[model samples]
Target: MSVLGSLTPLPAADHPELLAEPVVKALSRLPDASGVLVAEIDPDLADTAAFCEAYSSPPEFSANCVVVSGKRSGEVRYAACLVLATTRADVNGVVKRRLDVRKASFAPMDEAVELTGMEYGGITPLGLPEGWPLLIAPEVAAAEAVVVGSGIRGSKLAVPGAVLTALPGAEVVEDLARPA
Candidate 1:
């Protein structure tokens, strides 16, 4: 069974009060979401293998979304939601090309927090501000299921890969990530 099937189904619009503010806001907008429990985790847990082992799930069940940013004409634009595990976001090549910027780089921490309303360690693609570029690796889309942040540190949300694509502003692309 998919991990999402095994999780407790909380009201999609009602996330725990302990959740980070941005995650809570995002969950409020997604009326059909659910959450799964994980052992308390640190903020910088970026690797899926580590997260899965800590959460006691298969690596493929864990999805990691990175927010990449670049500057143009002294203004910075950010892109969020790179891929699941095993793939790294191609910020300088594919993503730069997609954004039509001459020089692109990952958004700095302060800007990332300000723009997404997520803490440095807990950003999810679900409730990103309108128009933030959301790139999904094709491999992730091919998965039977994937797990993403619940906008909180201690929980995750598992859903069909297709459901992720259906989210507002999500764009599925080929070779969207660099191999880990």
Candidate 2:
């Protein structure tokens, strides 16, 4: 794994305080979570661009998890998409068809935060609700190391992409993301 600038990444399992409750719980369930690492960061720089700049990690090396929702037959369905920071999830085209919904849009901030039990900018696919689909862009799923949320703004997690692919409901899709 390459150095993530000046940030110090330590074994995530040894420091539960750096992760949110949901993430910690999720990590416990993963048999291959040994490669996961965590590093402290300024909450104010949690957003992608600022984070990449501050931490000296390229956007392509970071995965941003976004929550999306759509309705079908009067029922609402939610899914999480983990795409590289350098790209954008193709919600209207590929994702809409994948979810079998008429259209898909980003979930409301409050709804996402409440349902995931994680901060708005810190939501991750690892601990999503039981049935939520986790759509991973191919690039993110194939990476050796990727920076992702630790389910909180004050810290970030460095995880092997294989661990993400091992998560429940994770699906790697072609054209899952388009250029940002």
Q: Every model's Cα RMSD, please?
A: 3.3, 1.1
- The global C-alpha lDDT for each of the candidates, from Candidate 1 onward, is 0.67, 0.89
Estimated TM-score for each candidate: 0.79, 0.97
Q: After superposition, how far is residue 11 of candidate 2 from its true place, in Å?
A: 0.9
Candidate 1 lDDT at 157 equals 59
Per-residue CA lDDT of candidate 2, range 1-180, in tens?
Answer: 353556999988889898888899999999967899899999999897899889887777889999999999999989999999889999999889988999899999999999999998889877899988899998988998899998999988888889999999999999999999
Q: Who wins the lDDT comparison?
A: 2
lDDT of 1: 0.67
Please report how far candidate 1 places residue 51 from its true position, in Å.
Answer: 2.1
Over the stretch 53-103, how does candidate 1's per-residue lDDT look in tens digits? 654666656667888877778777777855767667887899988777788
